[model samples]
Target: MPSRSGPSDAPRWCVLGRVPGGGVARGRVAAVEVDAAGERSAPIPIATAELPAFVAARERSAPRWVWSDTPSWYPRLLEAGVRIERCHDLRLCHAILSRSEAVPDRGPLLAAARWEAGPGAGEGEPAESALFEIETPEDAPGAVPHDLDAALEEFDRQRAALAACVDPGRLGLLVAAESAGALVAAEMAAAGVPWDAAEHDRLLSAALGPRPARGAKPVRLLELAEEVRAALGDPRASLDSPPKLLRALRSAGIDVESTSRWELAEHEHPAIRPLLRYKKLSRLLTAKGWAWIDEWVRDGRYHPVYVPGGVVTGRWASSGGGALQLPRQLRPALRADPGWVLVSADVAQLEPRVLAAMAADGAMAAAGSGRDLYSGLVEQGIVGTRQEAKIAVLGAMYGSTTGDSGRLVPRLRRSFPAAMRLVDTAAAAGEQGGVVSTWLGRSSPRPGDEWEELQARASLPGATSRDESRARRAAREFGRFTRNFVVQGTAAEWALAWLAELRLRLARLPSPTSAESIAPARASGPAFERQPHLVFFLHDEVMVHAPEGQAAAVAAAVRESAEAAGRLLFGSAPVDFPLELRIGERALKE
Candidate 1:
C-alpha cells in the first residue's frame, strides 16, 4: 500500500498560485494551471503566510515531502491552491517535481501568459516567472508519430475526463494523471490515449443521460430529530421509558452525559446554523441507508474506518462512516467480540507537554514527571481552585476561550512568564504571517493572502495607538501557534512511540482461538481491554482492539510505550512527556 500516513510530508494540495506583494486587500494573482475544461490545478503544500507554523512534528530525519498521484479518500486541503515551494535544496526539489504527480499539463505555455523576453537573453538574474521554455520533443529524431504538440494537447483533456469517471476500479497504481478535474499524475510511459475534447464531452453528456428535473426540497433536521424526553432512561425507573430511535445507545454501555460535553462547542459555530436549518443532514445518507447502520450494531463489533491524517493539521478520518463523530453514548456500539476486550486510553493534556518544551517551562516539566500535572497545578497555587487550575493551564497551553480558562489565563500569565511568552509569540507570528516550529522540524504554515493582509497591516506605521494595540494583537495571534505547536508536535511523537510499541506487542501474541474472527473480543463484551493491539490513534487518544486474553498487557504496553517515547524524545519523559490515562467504552468521563 501507499504510505498514506501522510499524503505529502508537507500536506497534499491541488492548486498553486501567488497573491501579489502586500496584497491581501488586492486579490489579483496568477494561477499555475487551469484545465481546458475549466477546472484548476494547484500544489499541495501550503504557501503564502500559512507556510511557517503548520508543519508537523515528525522524526528529524523524515523526508520533507511526499506526493500522491493516485486519488485519495483522505482530506488534503489545497486552499485556492497549495503552493509547491521550490525546495530550498535543489536536489530534493528536483527529485520531487520529477514525479508525474508534479508534472505540468502543458509544460508552461508562454503564449498563455503574454510573453515578453527578459532584460537580456542571458541576464545574470532569471525572472521569477514560472513559465517554462517548451522544447517540442525535437532532436533531428525519426519522423515520430503525428504532430507531438497536438497529440499532447489532446491527451490533457482526455486524461481529465477519465479522472472524473469516479469508478471504484480506478484504485490501483499510479495510473494516468487524469486532468479529469485536474487531479491526476501518470507514469508507466504508455503513449497518451487519443481523446478529442468535443467527443469526450459528447460521451459524458450521453452517459449522464437526461438528469431528473428539480425535486422536492430537502428534509428538515428538526423533523428528523425525534426528541427522547430524557437521556434514554432513568437508572431507577423500570424499563418504563420507551426507547426512541438511536436512544437505546444508553443500554449498550455508553455514557450519554460525558460525550455530549466534547461536542458542546460544535453547536456554537456560525455555520452550524445551516445544519440546523437542513436537519436531515444529521440523518443517514437516506432512509434506505438506515439498514447499513443497523448492520454495524447487529454484527456486535464496530469497525470505524481509520483514516490516516484526517484533520487539517494531519489527523486521521473515520470513513466506513464518521466513526469519530459518534455520540459518546453509543460507545457500547464498539463492544468487544467473543474472545476480546477493548483497550482504550487517552493522553491527558497532551498539548501541554509540547508547550512546556516549546516554552521551556521547567515548572510544568517538573509537574509532568512528578505527579498528575493538572492536579499539581491546582495544589501549587497556580490558580484559585482545581477547576480554575484546569482552565488556566489549558488556556495557557491551548489558547482556548472556554470557561474559567478564559479569565484565569491573564492571572496564570503572571506566574508562568516563559510559557506565556511562547504562546504570545506564536500567536504574534500567526498574526504577522510568520512560520512557527516545534522541537521537531514541523512548522506552522503561513495563512494565505487574506489572513496575511490582516497581519501585515496590523504592523504599519499608522496601525495602532499608544497602547501598543496592534503589536499586542499580532503577538497573541502568533502565540496561538507557538502555544499549540510544541504540545501538538510532542503529543504526535508520543503517539508514534505508542503505536510502534503496541504493534510490537500485538505481533508477539499467539493467534486468537477463533480464526474466523473478523472482529474478536477479549472476555465479555463492553469493557475495553488494556492491550497492545492499539489499532487506532487520534491526536492524544488511542484505541486498541485487543483479544480478551491480552487486554491488560496491551494497556500496560500503551503506557510504557508513551513513557518510553518521552524518554527518547527528551532524556526522560518524567520531565517532558508524562503519560496519564483512563479507560471505558465512552470517550469521556462525566
Candidate 2:
C-alpha cells in the first residue's frame, strides 16, 4: 500500500477506488497543472487509511475529489470527520454531459458506457442497504467500475467533454452543484430532521381518532363508514375497495366514473363528504401512520433518505419516508431540540422566477421583482388577481388550454411574451419529437421507441384518422411534460446551487457553545452535532437545525445563498430569487 505523502503545491484532483488489499488507492490526477510539454501528470496512488490526513492537508488547496459516486466515498470520509470542499462525481456528470445538447463533442462521454450505469442503492432503494452493493438495472450500461484506473479514465473523459462544450463555464457550475447536492443528500440523511414523536402521535390521534385495534377501523372512521354505507342504502358496503365503492356510489344515484376524491367532490351527495374524509384519513394512515413512525423516526429524528437527481427534470425524490410528500398537517411533529431552532426557508415561485431569468424577459422579471411574484404580476396589471396570475403562469408552463387556466394563459402571453414563447417553443419541440435542455444543460430524456413508432406509424401512407388522433394526443401529452421540464429542471438546478452554497456558509458558522449543546448527538456523528447543519430539504424548501443563538445568522446565510445562486446561474440578469423564511422552535404553525 502507498503511504501518506505531503500535500502538493500544485492543484490536483484525487480519484479514490478500492484496491485488492482491503484498502483503497488514492490516485492524484492534476486538476490544472501541466508540465513544460503541456501534459498532465499521471495519477499517484495513496493508501485509503491515510486519506483523512492527506485530505486535511490539501483542504486549503481545495482539490476536487474525482469519485465514481458521492454516496460511496463522502459518507466514510464524513464518518472519519473529514469534509471535502469540492468534487466531480463521474456518475452524475456522465449522466448530464452525455445527453447535454451544449456538448457537441460527446462522442467520448457517450462511449463510456460503464459510467452510464444507473445509480445503485441511492434513489428509491432502502437506506440500510450497502451503497455499492445494490443491483444495477438489467438493461443499464454496466456499473462504473470502482477502480483507481477506471476513475482516472472517466474523469479524463468528463474533463475533455466539458472542455469541448460551447459553454463550459455554466456546464462546469452545474456539475459542481449537482455533485454538491449528492453530498448534501447524504449529510441530510445523517443529520435527520428534528421530529417530535409525541407530537406526531397526538396529531394522528386528533385526525384519525386514536390508533385502531390492529386492522380494525378507528372510532371516527367507523362512524364515517357507517354514514357512507347508509347514504348508499348498503349496510355492508366495502368503503376500502375502490371498485366496490364505485359500484355503491352508482347504485346510490351518484353518477361518477371513479371513486377518486376530485370526481366525488364534484357531486353534492350525502356520502361524498364522508368518502373524501375517509380517503384523506386513509392516506394519512398509510403514508405517515404509527408503523411509519416506529420505522423512520428514531431518537427524535426523522432520517428520510433523499435521492438527488432522482427525477429526469433534476428534481429530488425520496426513496423512503415520503420526505418530499410531507403533509402540512404533520408539520408540528418537526420540532427542534431544546436549545436549538429550525430555520425553514423556501424560494417563492422559484420556477417562474427561473423562467423570467432564462428568457431574459424584462417585463416578466419586472413583474416578479419582489418576493411575491404573483402579487407583483397583479401590480403590473397583467392579471386581475394574484390567483389569476398564478393560474396564468402555471398554465403557460404546463400547456394548459382549457377552463380558467387556458383563458388566463393567453393573457400572460400578451403580457410576458418572451417567457411565454420560451415554454411554448419547448412544447412545440416536444410535439415534433425534439429534445429540450434546461438552463444548466440537463436535457430532457428523448421520447421512447414506442412513441417514435406511434408517430412513424401515424405518418404511414394508409394511416387511419384514429391513429393520427392517438399520435397527436400522445405528442400533446409528451409536449406538456417537456414544456414544464425546462422551467422545473432549471429551478431544480438553482435550488441545488442554493443548497450547495448554503451548506458551505453554514459550515463556516461558529459551532454551538457547550451551554447551547442541549440537543442529543446527531447521527451525522460528532462532526455536525454542534454545527448548524441542514436537516431537511424538499423541492424548494430547506430546514436547518441550528442553535438558537445562530438562528438569525443561519437565516441570513439562507437568504444570501439564494441571491448568490441566482447570480451564479444568471449573472447580471435582473431577476431575484426571494425566500420565505421562518425561524421557530417547531416547523409547524403557531
Candidate 3:
C-alpha cells in the first residue's frame, strides 16, 4: 500500500531492486520511479556505498518504497539510521492477494510460484555478504526474486489484482498494514526488549531452586519427584514416562486415564499435589531455563524473531525466543534502560468488540460501552454473572454446544441476535465448505480435498453409519473453526493497523535532548539507541521503550492509535476498544 499520488489519489511509488554483475557490498542498486498512471521512469543506479544516503534524500518526497520483501530491504536502511514513512511490500502483498476471496482475478498471482516464497530466512542478516547485494538468492532457496525485473513484474501483477478486487479500499488497507507490520517486526528485533540477566536468574532460582549441574534435575524438582514416588510406594517408578506414571497412579488407587492436570485433579491421591507442581516447574525449566537465557539474551536485550502473519488468522508467531509464550512470572526481567521506561498496554475483550462492530449489533455495542464487556452483560441482565457472560460469548464464537457454555449461549443469542446471526451464518457456510472473510477482506482457507471427499462418500448410497458419523464430526469441526475465524481474523487486522499507526506517532515525537542525566542504550542501535521505539508486541498488547521524560507521551500515543484503528476499519461504529495500560521501569501486571 503506497501513498496516494494521482487525481484518483493513488499512492506514488519508488521501486528498488538489486543490479546484477556486482559483488556483495560492491553491488550497484537499481531503482525506478512509478506514477499512479502506470508510467515508470528509467532505472537509476546508485553505488552500494551510497544507497543509504540516496534513500534518505528520496524520503523527503514521501513516496512509498516498493520492494521485493521488507526483511530483505528495510533492515539495512534501519541499521544506517534511515527510515521510510511508507512501503508497498510486493512479496507480502502477493501472498494476501493470491489467497484472498475478494480478488476476482487471482490467476496471475497464483501461477507465480516464485513470489510464493516464504519469508526471508536470514531476516536481520544482509542479503549477501553485505547489505547491498540484494539480488543474491544463493542462500535462500525458493526465495522471492530480488532482481529489479522480477520485482517490477510482481508489483505490476499485484496492482492489477488490487484494481480488479472487490472493495479495493479494504483489501488495500490490509496489504498496507501487513507490510507495515513487517517493518515493525524488523525494527523491534533490532531494538529488542530490555532484559535484566540478573533478575532473570534470580527469578529462576526462586522458582526452581538453584540451577542444577548439567544434565541433572534442579533441587526442587528432585524433591517433588521423590515425594510423588514415596506417595505411590514405588521408589523406582519413572516419573518422566507417561505410561509408567499412569501405571503407578493405578497401583496407588488413583486410576486416571492421563496425567493431564484436569484428570489428575479429579483424584485425591497424595501424589497428585507434588506431581502437578513438579510438571509446572519442569515446563518452565525446559522452555525458559538457564539455557534459554544464554541463547536469547545479549547486551541486556532479548531479541525474539517475530513472524508477522504467521498464523492463518494473521496473528504473529515467533521462530525463536518463545516470544508468544513468555510467562508472566518472568515479566519482571523486562527492565528498561537507565534513562528509559516501558509503556505497555493491551485491548480489553478485543474480539467481542470487533464482533459488535462487524455485525452492526447496536445492543451488543451498548453493552460494552465504556466498561468491562462481561460486566456490561450482567448489568444489562443478559447473564447472571461476569463469568457466565464470558463463557457465553466464548461459546458463541467458538461454536461450543455443550455444558455451561452451551446452556448460557442462548441467552446471549436472544439478547444480541445480530452478533449471533453473523457468526451463525459463517459457521453454516464453513460447514458446506464455503469461504468466509474478515471485515477487512482476509478470507479463511477452504476445507481440503480430503474433507470434500469424505463428505461426498458419506452421501453416496450404502454408506456405513461410521462414515456418516465421521463426516458429521468433520463438518462440525470446520464449523467451529469458521465461527471464530471472522472475529479473530478481523481482530488481528485491527491490531496490525494499531501497530502501524502508533509506530508513525512514536517516530514523529521530538528526539530527547542530550543531558548529563540521560544515559544511552547503545544496544538498540542507531535508529533507536537515543529515541523512543517499539520493543515488544503480542497479538493485542504493545510495549514501547522510551526515554523517561517521554513515557507519558508514548502512553497517549498508544491509546490514540487504538481509537484511530477502530475508526479506520469500522467507520463510526459505536463499539469501544478500551485498554489496560502500565508505565514503569519494568513490565509488570497490575
Candidate 4:
C-alpha cells in the first residue's frame, strides 16, 4: 500500500517512455528480478494500427500486462506464451487499475519482461536482474551499426554483472552495484590472488586479500567471468554527493572500493547504515509512486501530467509528464525531448513557510529568510543552540521526537500560546486518528466506526487486549492526520498562489508571436514575452519551460508569484516568504 513519501515506504516508479504528438509506453512495474522474464516474454500488441494506443490501456494494470509499439506485435506476442484477455482493453484497464482513487479510470501497463517482481525480488530469485533495450537515438535516429551491436551486447552482459540488481531496497547495491562488482574483480585481480575456477570462497578470499573469515560459509559461483572485464573507465566511482548529505562518517573520506562491496553485500559502514536503510525504504515508496505514474508513458503518448489548478490552492499542473520525485542521485536520467529543454526548479523550505503562515508564527517566519532556512534558524537565539532550533522547529512541523523541538515545544507553549495551542489541538486530534481539515473543504480521512469504539475503550481503564491494540492503531493513524493537516493544507494553498501568479505574470512576459507563443530567454535561447506557460510542478516546486531569451524576467515572475502567494495567504503577515531563483542550461543545481 502507498505510504507517505518518506523513509517509511520503499522507492516506487512508474517509468514512462513518451514521444511528442502524444504516443507512449508506461510501466508502473519494477523490472528488477524478472528482467529476463520481461525480456523473454513475447511482446503483445495492446494498440493496433486500427486503434489509438488506448486499446491495450485497459489491461495495462492487470496482474501484469504489456503493450508493444503496434498491434502487429500482438501476433508475435501470442507466440511468446503471454495470455491476452479481452478485459485488457484501454478503457477497462484504466478503470480497473487506477492511478489514484479519483483517477481510478486509468491503468498503467506492465513491461512484459519484468512480471513477477515487487519492492524486492522474493525467494528463489537471483539478487540481480535487468532490462536491456536498444533505442534509436533521437539525434542520430538510426539502428546500431553491426560493429556497435557486438559492443552493445557485451556492454549489456557486463551491465548485468551488477546493474541488474533485483533489490532496489538495498541502497548500497542500488547506487553502484555493477560498478562495484567490476571494481571488486579489478581489486582482487590486482591483489594477485590465485587465478579463479577454484572454490568460490577461496577465490574471493584471495581476491580480497587477508580478511577475517567466518567458518563454513556457502558461496555461489559468479556467472560471466568475461562480463567482469569491462571496468576501465577514466573517472572512478563517486563516494561524495555535492550538496552535502545529512550524515557523518560520509562527510569526509569515503572509499568507493569498500563502498562498492558494501553495496553488493547489502551492508554499509555503521555510520552510513541509517542512510542506507532510509534509501531502501524511500525506493520502495518511490517505486509504488512510479507504478501510479507509468499509465501515461505506455504507447508513447504526450499526456502532459496535469497539476490541478497548478498549486494546491489554484494552478494548472502538467497535463501528462514531469519527473517530480527526482532524487539527488537520479537527475541525469531525466532527459528532455529532442528539441525541448528541461526546466527544473525547486521551492526551498516550502513546508516551513506554510507552517509559518498557518500558525502566524512570526518568529518562525522571521527565521525562514531567503537562504537555507534551517541554517538561518541557526543564526537565531530563539533556542539555546542550532541543533536545538533544528529539532524544535522540525518537531513542531512534523510531530517528530528526540530533538530540541520535543523539549522546546513545552516552552513554545508557554511563549507562543497561539501557535503552540493550534498545533497542539491538531496534534491531539491526530493522536486520536482524526483528520483535521484545511480551511477549504478538503478534510482528512477519518477512522471508521469500529475505530471510534476501539478508541473509546482505549481511553477506559483496564481496557481488554483487543481494545488496547485497536486504540494504539487508531492513535497512530490519527497522529499522521493531525501532523500533516496543516502543513499539507497550507502547502496546497501556496501552490495555488504560485500558479496564479505565473498565469497572470506570463501575460507581461513578452510573447513575440501568437503563432507559436515564443517565451523569452536570458541569452540567445528562448525567452518569454510577457507571461511564461506554467509547464509543471512537483509537490512544492514549479517549473516553467519557456523561451530562453527572457530568463531574468521569467525568474522575476516566479519570485513575484511566490511573494504574492504569501500575501494572499498571510495577508502581509510579518514574514519573509522569498522564492530563491536558479537558471541554467539544465535544472539549477539544488
Best by TM-score: 3
Name the candidate, 1 or 4, with the larger TM-score value.
Answer: 1
TM match of model 3 to true structure? 0.95
Report the C-alpha displacement of residue 20, candidate 4, in angstroms.
Answer: 35
Question: RMSD to the native, candidate 3?
Answer: 2.8
In angstroms, the error of model 4 at 92 is 23
Question: Worst ten-residue run, lDDT, model 2?
Answer: 132-141
lDDT of 3: 0.87
Give TM-scores for every candidate, taking all chains together and pairing residue i with residue i: 0.48, 0.91, 0.95, 0.46
- TM-score result, candidate 2: 0.91
Decoy 1 TM-score against native: 0.48
Give the Å error, residue 242, model 4.
31
Q: What stretches of model 1 exceed 4 Å from their correct place?
A: 1-303, 318-320, 400-406, 455-479, 510-532, 576-590
Better of 2 and 3 by TM-score: 3
Which lDDT values do the candidates have, in the order given?
0.40, 0.82, 0.87, 0.40
- Give the winner by lDDT: 1 or 3: 3
Candidate 1 per-residue C-alpha lDDT over 221-280 given as tens digits, one digit per residue, 9 for 90 to 100: 322222221333423322222343224434533434422323322434322233233322
lDDT of 3 at 492: 96
lDDT of 3 by residue, 289-393 (tens): 999999999888898888888888888888878998999999999998897888999999999999999999999999999999999999999899999999999
